[model samples]
Target chain A: MRHIRITAVVIKELIQLKRDPRSLVMIAMIPLIVMLLFGVGYGGGTGKISIAVVNLDKGSLSWTVLDSIMKTPSVYVKAYANSIEEGRELVKDGTVSATVVIPEGFTEELMKGASTQVLVIVDESITTISSTIRNAMLAVTYKFQQELVRSVGGSSVELIYSSVYGPKVTNLEAFTPLVIGIVLQLVPTSLISIAICKEKERGTFEQLIMSPISRYDIIFGKLLAFFIATIADMLITLMVAVWIFDVSVRGPLIDAMVVSTLFLLGSLGLGMLISVLSRNQLQANQAAIFIFIPALLFSGALMPIDMLSPSARILANLTPMYYFVSAFRDIMIKGFGLWQITWEVFALSVYMVLMMVTAPLVLRLRVD
Target chain B: MEYAIEISGLTKKFGDFVAVDNLDLRVRVGEIFGFLGPNGAGKTTTIRMMCGLMRQSKGTIRIYGYSIPEERSELIKITGYMAQRFSLYEDLSVYENMEFFGKLYGLNGEGLHKRIRELLEFLDLEDVKDRLAGRLSGGMKQRLALGVALIHRPKLLVLDEPTAGVDPPIRRAFWEYLRGLNKEGTTILVTTHYMDEAENCDRIGLMNKGRLIAEGTPKELKRRIFGGDLVEVVLQGRIQGDVIKGFLNVGDLKYKDGETVLRLVLKDASKELPSLLKRLDSMGLKVQSAEPINVTLEEVFIELVTKSEARVRGEAY
Candidate 1:
């Protein structure tokens, strides 16, 4: 751990990275582009689901249900069809996500206080959109029943709901921490994963290891350089999240940054391990994706870890990202303090330490 | 004699393949020792083992009294290595590369800057100090690699094929620098396949198939292959080749120029030639002219490699 040797390597790394504009642009743009994609794609709440409507009943009660479905904020009536066949055609041809049909004699059956069914046809190929459409139609039916009861002068009970996060939390806001977790996890990991392998590929590793520096110096030096270079990535991700998308951070922003820094170091450490293990840049890139895709999928970045099977949950727990995403969510959305997220922070620290230590230990100082 | 590098029974293997085998060598202090071999002859492997860039599978290496792998840190301080390929950071400026390597050897501040300045001037790289190494011409890059290797003023400099692909003039100039470095008392161990270049070494070791087939001064290797130096003579008068062969010292004899010219192998050309000419004068045979024939290292290298291969084949049978 001689400071002078480490400083020398760090300075050399910085100069090389600075001179390579392509890598610099990639570091900045990856986070920006990924965040923008998430913000624009999922940010506006799944973008106005379109469905077709078919009214077969002779009474005006069917139009009331249609009006309620159209009034729901996320639902859009794309077309009106004369028969269930035509409505089904619209859904099959992908003209709309689903079709809502009112059965014949529906208002007559309701007036006699008898059970009636309204049919909804949906395209199940696009599962998310189809499920959303189904939920919207269910809500429309529930509302219509409640109104019918109120008109008859019977007492109606209102179903009220509450959330730990405020009721106004948008989809984008709730998912902001997940986006940050992803940006911090994959971007830095991908960037630093090729550091050592690139040197080895260029034939410079032979010269570098010939110097008097130790294995710790090389590993830690790269860690410091990549950390300085990519901390900007994290900042840009947060800025886009907060200023542009208006993602609210309920707790102190600095606390979120501290947690983010821990996660960032862990990612860099993981990448360093990969870099040391790989013999070439292509191998390093593939290995980075190999490890991170699993982390992204199982670590609750896209879905809750609890939703996974019990054995899969064990895999999620193994990923440092799960704890970071969970902790970031608590800090940003739930307003939890550092004291509440100590376990997450401790787990991240342990991961970072393990990787950072293992990298140098596994790194053979010889090119052969 | 004090040796800059000492090795015995050095062996290196990759899984089941042997790269360097059962090697023994010593490079004397403050002299240029050239390790010469064809491609894949284990020249680079031997250099790597000596410089501690690789670990030998068996045997011992001591550079300047520091045992390798155990005392590699100490060895690193006193040794500078220039790999066969240009391995400096190409993206870095010439000055930055030197500065980085200089600092790695624990050089810093004014002292480090002073050493870098001296090396830049010495290697004639001051003008391109700010140029990126990747942008330099082949010759300049070679010079810069040498400069980086010499930055710390090491006691020993190990170079692996420093002039493999450079043109002739640059190769000559590079040797001049190496000679200059040697004059300053930096023991050099360089490896190359160029036969002419090995002539510049104070001592030469010819390796083929992971074995040091021959080792000596350039002159000694030539004499060893031919059994003696070749000397050609012409006599004007009638002289049977047998008469001269009987008078000559321990040697081989061949005739040319219509029986007047005789080529003979002598124990020592410079010493034996005068007496042979005197013997012809004493025998009433007028001597026309005589000169020692020069033997190129290329011939010696080929002969030695061919003989060693034959021996190996014979043993295999």
Candidate 2:
């Protein structure tokens, strides 16, 4: 409650911030890297793709289809292997995003007026990408089948391929900013909190408490140092997206900084909250991870909120990451303005307020 | 003299355990009062409550007549504490540590600089002024902790187990420094398990299980504990308890620490020493040397703790 007491702690924290550079870079650099990983990663997807080839009947007609595939962009070619497991491993290791195996008796089947099936091995780790790619692959397979039937003088056979989501989006760009947001939010909240917890574990909290500073001063002091580090990292991640990955930051620069700073408050508040709850570094770490991981995963970061059941979707809205991702993507990708993100700011403010209100009450007198 | 610290019926309970029971204590202005007890005897807890670091479950603590928890902020203005461990910035240099704490007390500019300079010179820590506190020796660390506590020049200073690990010579030096502070009218309340340290205090508080069993001047406690003077005789071999009693011409005799120890009336002392020595020699006893010394804080501790425990069991002794 004392003004000087709180301010004194704030100054001491600044000195500590000046000394530790690694934490500074972590806050600034980590977000930028995550941004690029999401930007180039998700931005590169174009459309559904499939590959079909006829080795024996690969006469003129097969070459025409092959040439179109080589020339065509978006639909990636799935290299055929001798065994299905070999193809499956390729998908497993992400060597090939998806694989299409062409049947060996293709030429004979066409001559005998019988149909052959082409199997698509998809890596569902990214179910959206996998399903979209699978559809493109199956479409190519049907095209190849129809062409072979005409060449062999037989009746055309229609193919049956099913999709869980109809008319999927070819430009599935939404996941990138969401993933990047999740990582950025997760690291600062958990790692910085861990850093604070480490100070507690090492008995440095005693030093801080015994010093002439007050609790608010100490809390505000740490917040400044951590904020600088986080801002630097955010800038780095943003730069990588703009320069390297070509992901646009369509929002106003000042607006982005404001959002990042407010989000930083919310994140740091979460960190401080974890710090106050756990007495030791390990316990604090476990607690931080518990709070961070679920917030990121269930906060509609990696997957769509619609895919989650109604209850989980509602719960995801409660997390700060949900608003952050929504607002960040709106600003970066969707080009939404500050007025549209009013709710995100409101949510973050609430998070920050709750943390500011509760964290100090848990500020321990001593480990004993 | 005015009381710098006053606590009455101060009780601290966590769940079902009482760390500090209903206790009352007053520290006179500018007096070095020592609180002595073994570990886990609630010394630190009591100090913390007095400082307003921890809220007391019951009773009132007034620091400079400012009621605690209510006047905690004002109380913080005038109080400085050095934790049990040498709790200072271990990574920071001694100079940096002082400056940071100086800022905490709302000190700045030339006034802060002068105060810091005085502290460095007073503690003899000028030579290693820039050395990291982590690398300092136990004695040097103790000095630095004390210096940091004195940086703000608070009227009352409380130290919890300040020198639990420092050697004898350094401890003697630390006590001398504390006495110097007291002479300048800075009241100090320090806790220790070592009985010898309690002797340096103007008055002492003997605490056991959250209660102040006894409190008085060192001389008064010693006289009351012994009811007379303790006669200590240094010997080569350990004296048997029964043999010691038989050799005594006056009151009870007891053997302790490989020496024949007994308390007797001062009037019988001169006559008893010769006859006791002769009797030992006649019995072919190898008496290395013999001298009667004064009752010490160690004896007073034993006298009080033993009696207090016996009283708790309702045994009349």
Candidate 3:
């Protein structure tokens, strides 16, 4: 409640934070490291589905089918096996995700107007990728049949693909907002979560509370110090996503900064609440991770909330991460300004207010 | 007399265990008051309640004229506390620690800086001003803790076992500083288990089993426990022990040296010994010598605690 007392606490905390090497490294380098990990994991374009092709038919039509399979953007023809056994060996040895075998009489059957099947052998261990490989193969065969019909003089209609942002939205660009939201959410929360508990464990809180300072002074002072220390990492996280990974941001940079500043405050508030409730540093650390994992999973950062069950959707709607990610995506992808994201702004404000108010209420001025 | 701290009916209960029970204590202004007890006598609990660090389950505490827990904010400004443990920020330098605490008490700018310098010099901590608190030796760390507690120049300084674990020389020197502060008109309430240290207190309160069993000056407590000062008297001739027992000022009498020497408990040995010698001379008994025997606080403490325990046992039956 007193400005002098709060300023004293803020100055003391800043000096302590500056002198602590471990915390300094966490604040300076964690965002960059997390962003790099996100870039490496998601920047490679959903990982091309690699498959091996075994051509048994000597006819020109089988070569055309093989070429069509190799030409599909999502599919990669990693190896040309001499026999079906070798192709199956490639899939079995994990060299490729799946194996496609063209039978010996594929062109003859198609010329006689009889339907014949192409055998596809796949390793099912890589569940998601193998399923995607199956779908890619099905599209390849369908396109080859259409080409045969068109060459025989049948009329055809074409389909075109376009994105709302542009005709070509790269994988990294589309995922930038999600990665930024995660970095802003997780790094700052984990960094500041142990602030109060560390004081309690070290016996310093006994001395701290002896001063004529209120709970509001302690909570807000720590909140302000950690915000100053962590805001650098937030900016670096955004810069890494935009400049290093070449992810485009369609809206003004100020809009992103404003949204990020609000989200960072909310994240710091959540960490402060955790710090207040916990008895020690280890408890606070575990609580931060326990709360963050669920937020990351159900917040529509990794997947859409629509794909989740009803209860999970409710959870997604409850977390601040969901709103931040949604708001960030709108600004980055759609060039939306701060005024346009009304729901997200209101939700984040509510989350921030709730955390800042509840932390001091639960904080005990007494050691016991 | 004006009291710096007045506590009545103070009780602290953790579930069914009562750490401090129905305690009443008053520390006068501008005097060193010592709270003495054995381990688990609830000395620290009582001090914590007085400092508003812990709320009493059933009692009222007024430090100076302000009520506790209601006017705790105002009370904190004029009261400084040093815990039993070294509770200052160990990572901070000595000067920084003092500055931080001073500012919290609303002393700032030129005034805060001046007070810090004054305390550093007064506590002989100026040389180690730049050293981290955790890196200081045992004596220096205790000194810094004391320095921070004095940063706001509080009217009342409350210390809970400030000299719990230190060398004899440092403890003695630490008390010397306390004596100096007491001279400056600061009301000090200190708790310690060391009987020898309690001898320095202007008044001592002996607590045992959550109760103040005895309270007085060290000399008064010794007299109270042993029924007054013990004195030895020697006569040139044999004396009648029963006759001496009937003396007006004698509390108890015993003969040694084949009835020639007598050990007598007097109500006031200094006042009565001279008169007794004169009276014996008038009765045709030549007095050899008379002197008051010395009693240590350690002996007084043991005697008082044992008697209280015996009384408690007797009551239980």
Candidate 4:
């Protein structure tokens, strides 16, 4: 292992990075794009949902409850026609994603110590947000119940609800980290894999083999460039997220970088491994895209992994992105420290070490 | 100098197919050695084996007293290999390509810069030091590739068809540079399909069907090829008698052309030519020209390979 071999590989890799403009842009744009997707797409904060209020309740109690719900930032009431059909149409036409129907005499039932039902109409297809609104209404009901008991000289009433897990948030800050992680996972791996394919396409790989540089040196050189590029993207994306989306990255900023870089190492190693096994550029791209598209889907970056089946959950954890997504969520949204995500960090580190360590053996230079 | 490369029973196989078989070659250091074969004749395989780029299935290769595969790094340290298609970082500048090789060879700082500057001028690529290699003409690119190979000042240069595509003038210029390198103590093992190019080698190894059938100096190969000399005689008029047969007994003789011309193969071509010439003159045939034209490597090579191929296939020549 001559010292020159490492330097030569590194310098050559840098030159290759400079030559490939597409990879350069992919690296620089991915993280920023993820952040923008996070900021604009996810981070605006999921409070103040629009609800068409079909107020058939001709009493003060229902009106007061509706007012309290609106004040809680849980739901904003838009007056619709008293007809139930119009309320259904509001939900159907998406003039409102949801609507609440208050029956007549709803407030008087309370005075008579009678139970009154509040008919709520909503689109079930918007499941996450529908559930979020459901939870907010329940909390408002709970508060109402507590206030009613106080008003009635401390006579507590039992309330029934089917769902658990309170809705504390609804917008982009919670998902920014996941988006960033997903973009981070995708860009470096795909770019580096494609770059390796380009070498095979151009026949520069033969020159690389004949040179004194070893396999490890070549792999390392490529990984370093990709890692750097991805990290740069990750930083730009994080900044945009912070400023534009208001998805403040919590915990140590450097730790965010550490997690992003390590995740990239795992992903790029997987890509390079694919590139090494692939005979041509098209195959390499297919393999990389296969990994990346599924990763973005199953990484639990958008929807909750909890919604998936047990086997799907297991498969989700099998991906390196799952750990990174978990790390980002915990750090950026949950505002957890390094110790809080020690397990996620450990999982990511293990994946990265395994992928990078075994990549060399997988990418054999078959001159025979 | 003693033989720089001594290979015996060298054979290379790809899984089941034998690419080079039982090849034996000996080339002296400081002498230009040529390996001649048609396309796919295992010329590249042999050169690659010598460079330690490939391992032989069976054989022993000793380059300047170092065993290969185990000592590939050692050989690669001092041996510059110019591949069939000379490779370079086409994106990098001419000087940058040289500096990269120099650094890889462990020359740095002023020494590296000085050597690069010298090679720049030597290859006549001075003004284009900053120009990308891909932008250069075919001849200039070849020169740049050569300069990169010479950056380490290798003792041996394994050039696989270094002059395959350059125009005749540039090829001539390239060979002159190569000869200059050989004079400065570089052992060059070169492969070319052109027989005229083979004539420049001090000794040549003629390969066919994965075997080296003949190996000797240009003169020795000629002598061995015919087991004698090649004499050419042309006359002003045609002749048909024992008078032509009385020309030479030293070797086989044949007359051709509209006039009676004969090529005589003999052991002592120089000593026999004048006697044969005088004999032709006395025979009352007006001689147009007479000379002892030695067999070209092409003749020697065709004789050896065709005979070998015929023998292997049991064909009558």
Candidate 5:
């Protein structure tokens, strides 16, 4: 392709985009909005959970157990039930996440130096909150057992815990790479496809095809324009994720930028393919959303890829966002270098090449 | 004679429907050729094929000796096309649109700027050169689209309904510009449904139902439809139709505005009109006026279309 012709198209597209205030605002603000919403909403494990406590044992030892449960940051004792039936009623009514039952004679058994158990009844419908409450209950019971063993003149065994990659990974920090992948893929893909389809809808595509510029020039010109704009968008998102959310980029920044650029190219290529297949802007927008939803679902962003079914794993391998999210997590969270993500880079490059080649071939210059 | 565009037996089909059926056309260099048709007459399809933007289902099209779909790259360089719609980028300024098209045509730097400036001045669009194309009025948008098409100074300009919705004065001005361009050796092939605009063409082809029904100059087409000159006579008193018919080799007779009008087919009208007038004087019917009337292209187009449709119905029956 001739450079001058490509430059002309690029400049024209940029001017058009600059004039369109709605699209510009959407491109710049979507990432910020998505990052802030997801980062702050799910950032720390649902901050405060309400649970019912049934203290049937009106003794000092049971109160100590209640104090331990209350001291945990995530759990809040919302309601006091006199019996286990009342606590179960509170759980059934969805008034709280779970119910803690301290049975009668629990303090008498503990004072006699006999083993006792605290019955924790939880609602399993809200799985995440239920699991979090369960874990907190286990920790509180373990602390009471250690205290009882220490006061009774028996040796206490301690267990130590450590994280392999992140010692203090918060929810926001863990999902930062996912946010980056989603922002890079969704925004550029939708914007670029809509831009090309708008030309087709407005009847300007016929004029472009009639000109001497080749199809490659048009595609590459559009890709270049969106790439620059989306890269700037990615940088802003990166800053927000790092500074505001306290998510660190542990690997080389250049490596992250390069991999992100590759992912952007792949996403833009998918957008071009959609533009080629769709007849108008509405169709293009619909098709982009159609692809984007599936890609996000299977990209290992929502759930781990290994946990998926065998066929689902194969399908996840096909989506470019999967490789992008994996590579981004590896570089950003796992502190891996470029060599560690060679496979993901290769996969994304292949996807980029395939989509870029197929788009122009499928694109029709004539109305037919 | 060098033909700017030559097509023989061009056909385009969408599944079972034939859009352009075995069409043959030839347009000479430096001539304004009007392609007149009603809606769905395959005018746009034929123009697209000629421009090499679309491939013909069958047959051959050669624009300036460059065969379509084979030499499409070469063909696009020499042909400028304005589609039936407003095809310029709406969000770009008028000058930006021109400059972009100029670069696409391989003109750049100072040369591109100069050509854009000259075109803006020539089309009288200098005042709105900085305005977005979407913000321009209908006439201004048409002018800008025309300017973009003319940016590369192509040898052949193919315009599809270039003035479909413009006002009459703007349409006239656009035609004047086309005439100036044709005078400077630029061949133009334009399509329109407006019969009045087709009258300005050096030659025209009327298409209907994917077929070329008629092709000629405006005068030639009128002659083909009416077969002779139309003569209107204002008599001192109204004359009966049978008496007028018995006079001579008149084609059709009708009474209009309380006068006798005769459609006459003669070997030569200038030679025969005077004697016809003398006979009218001798018959004791004073002739207030006798004159040959020029037929409008609109009448010819309607007559030809009605005749073709009748023929098709006759064939079906």
Candidate 6:
């Protein structure tokens, strides 16, 4: 491929992108907006979970437990129902996520050094909120048990959990790499595919095909342009993630950028393949979104791939984003070097090569 | 004897439908050749085959002695094709569009800049060089497309409906530019449905139903269609059809607007017209005007297409 021809295509595409301010703004701002939404809104666990409390005990110990649950940052006590029935109604009507009922136990049981259980009724329809409620209750009970043991002059044994990497990582920090993967996959893929399909729709594709430029030049030139755009988006998003959200990249920035560039190549290649397969911009947009959703879901971004079924795990291996998310986490969160994550890097490279090589072959020069 | 574009037995088929069939054509160097046909006449298909944009089903095409589909790269360097639509990047500035195409043709450095500047001035787009192509008027867009096609100074230019929707004055200006280019030894092969525009070509090939029905100069085609020139005579009073028929090879006679008009076919109108006038004077008929009416390209095209359709139907039966 001639460099001049490729340069021409690149320059022309850049000019077009500059003229369309709306798309340019979308490319630059979407990552920041999505990151802010995820980081601030859903970060460090969803805040203000609502639950109902029923205090049937006449003693003050039950009030102490209720106050402890209410003081927790993530839990919100909606009301103190007079009866267990009213608490259950609150949970059933979705007024609250769960109902914490203290049984009619006399304070004498705890005073005599006997253990009593708290009946926690919960709605199981919304799994995420229910799980959060369960964790909150366990935390409050654990604290109360420690205090009870200490007040009686008895030593308590505690189980402590630690992690090899990011021991104190927040939910936002853990989600940074996945957010990068999602942005790279969705934004650049759809943008490049739409750009290509728009050319075909507007009839400029015929002129390009008839020119002296080879097919590789056209595809590569376009891919390079969008790849640069993706890099800019990644930089802006990473800055926001690191400074604003307090997420750190423990590894070298160069390694992170390299892995990210490879991932971008893979995504851009997928976009080109979709562009070649689609007949118009609408079809291209649909195909890009279709691929993006599955990629995000199976990349272990939202959930661990190990939690997936065996067949789903195998399917996850086929997506470039899966390896990208894994490698991104390893490099950015775990501070692993390129040599340490060689297998993931190799997988991403292979995906990129396969997509880039096959895209042009599938591209039809004739409009019909 | 040198041909800029040569094709023999060129054929294209989409599944079972044949778009172009058993076509043979040769465009000479430095001459303007017009490809005339109605819609779906396979003109665009043949042009695309010549440009190597489509692979032919069966046959050979050589542009400037470069075999197409095999040496397409070499052919593309020497040939510039403007599609039927305004195919330039609409979002780019006019100068940017020209520069992009120029670079694709392997032009760069100061040379590319100079060529773009020259084209912008030549096409009267200098005033709007920085304006986006999508914002230009219809005539300006057509002119810019032509400018892009000529940026590389290719030896052969193939234009498909270069002025399809332009106003008349702009269309005439475009033809003038084409004529100027042809004078400077550039070969042009253009496809158009406009009959008046086709009359400007040095030679034209009329096509219908995927076949070339006729090929000649405008005058030659007119003579071939009617076997002579048509002479229209206006008389003050009605004349008997039989008396007008007494003249040899009188084509058609009709009364219109309170005057009797007579059409006659004469191989040599300059010699036969005077004799007919003398005969009319002796017959005591007052003549208002007498002149040889020029048969338009539209008339010739319609006649050729209708005759070909009838022949096909006759063969079918």
What is the C-alpha DockQ of each candidate? 0.75, 0.29, 0.65, 0.28, 0.70, 0.62
Model 3 Cα lDDT, one tens digit per residue, B141-223: 89999998888888999999999999999999999999999999999999999999998999999998889999989989989
Q: Residue A203 deviation, candidate 5, in Å?
A: 0.6
lDDT score of residue B272 within candidate 4? 73
If both were scored by DockQ, which would come out higher, candidate 1 or candidate 3?
1
**Candidate 5, B82-164: lDDT as tens digits:** 99999888888898889888988888889889999999999999999999898999989888888888888889999999999
lDDT of 5 by residue, A77-177 (tens): 99999999999999999998899999888889878878777888888997778889988988898898888777777887877898788587777877887
User: DockQ score of candidate 5?
Assistant: 0.70
Ranking of predictions according to TM-score = 1, 3, 5, 6, 4, 2
The TM-score, computed over Cα atoms with residue i paired to residue i, of candidate 4 is 0.84
Candidate order, DockQ descending: 1, 5, 3, 6, 2, 4
> Which digits, one per residue and each the tens of the lDDT, describe model 2 over residues B1-317?
39988899999998998989999999898889999988988999998887767789999998889998677767766777788877777767898888878887778778888988899999999999989888999999998888888887878889999989889999999999999998888999999999988889999998989889899888778767656444655555666666655535435555666665544443334666787778778877777666655667887888898998889888653
lDDT of 5: 0.86
The lDDT for every candidate, in the order shown, is: 0.88, 0.73, 0.87, 0.77, 0.86, 0.87
Give the per-residue lDDT of model 4 (tens digit) for A145-172: 7877788656676667564222354456
Better of 4 and 5 by lDDT: 5
Worst 10 residues of 5 chain B by lDDT: B260-269
Error of 5 at B26 (Å): 1.5
lDDT of 3 by residue, A76-158 (tens): 88898989899989988999888899988988988888888898998998677777887788788778878888887666665
- The interface root-mean-square deviations, each candidate in sequence, come to 1.5, 3.4, 1.5, 2.7, 1.5, 1.6
The C-alpha TM-scores of every prediction are 0.96, 0.78, 0.94, 0.84, 0.92, 0.89
Candidate 1, clashing residue pairs? none
Write out the backbone clash pairs for model 3.
none
Q: Write the number of the candidate with greater DockQ, choosing between 4 and 6.
A: 6
lDDT of 4 by residue, B1-317 (tens): 48789899999988787889998888888989999888999998988787776778899999888887677667767787777875787888898778777776778789999999988888899999999888999899889878888888888888889889789899889989998898888989899998888888988888888988788877888888677767676777666656655535434334556676666676787887777667767867788887778567787788888888878888553
lDDT of 1 at B307: 98
What CAPRI-style quality would you assign to candidate 6?
Answer: medium
Q: Model 2 chain A: which ten-residue window has the lowest total lDDT?
A: A164-173
10 residues in a row with least lDDT, candidate 3 chain B: B247-256
Candidate scoring better on DockQ of 3 and 6: 3
As for candidate 5, its clashing pairs are none
TM-score of chain A of 1: 0.95
Pairs in clash, predicted candidate 2: A6-A217, A28-A232, A28-A233, A29-A233, A32-A237, A49-A137, A50-A137
- Docking quality tier of model 2: acceptable
